[model samples]
Target: MSATFTEVLPARKSSKHSAIQWRPVTDDTHVAGVLTIHTDRASVAYTVSEFPTDWPGRGFLLAKETAGTDPESERYSVFCAAAGPWGDTCDCKGFTYKATCKHVDAVRALVGNAWL
Candidate 1:
């Protein structure tokens, strides 16, 4: 099935917000997070990292699945880079400190590179 992603922001911002919820739809579904996906019968919504909305109930997001031998499994390797239509992100200290990281560089090289 094809999936489309979307981003949503709160009507307003506030603190003390600590809930997430999922309500069933007749023929539609949406997942809200740091990114989102939409489908005929199921959809996912991702929040903006810059200014996140308050989750209405409780939920957990599984962004990736990796083997124990993978670098993702290393404590110091908490981040891997991503790039493309939805945008780009990396979670390493370099990314956090400098807003750039080798992981992103590697991804760009592997993909033949592009300017944003």
Candidate 2:
């Protein structure tokens, strides 16, 4: 599935927006593959098997950051998929100060509006 969201601020000179592109992963390691925030950023790989076993009505997402141009540069962060007041969480560097990461944002954007 593929989707794009653009937040354009007329007052601002810069274009503020993000895009999410995901697809079902057939590999044994992951369930879905994705990229968020900007295409230049790393892709996020998701897996249902790793979801918190005790969390009800919730699943897990593992966002992996990879540089296609540089194969060795790769990293991943864990995230929780939940409903209601509780939102997604991630261990990515941005989460330390923002409490969320691009992975969570991408998932939210995917779930907040539609499906693939």
Top candidate on TM-score is: 2
lDDT to native, each model: 0.29, 0.45
Model 1 — TM-score against the truth? 0.26
Per-residue lDDT tens digits of candidate 1, residues 23-43?
222243332223222222223
Q: State the local distance difference test value for candidate 2.
A: 0.45
For model 1 the local lDDT of residue 33 reads 23
TM-score of each: 0.26, 0.52
* True lDDT of residue 75, candidate 2: 47
lDDT of 2 by residue, 11-95 (tens): 2112244455555444656455443334344333443234554654345445345443235524444444555425566655556
Give the residue spans of candidate 1 off by over 4 A: 1-87, 113-116
lDDT of 1 at 48: 19
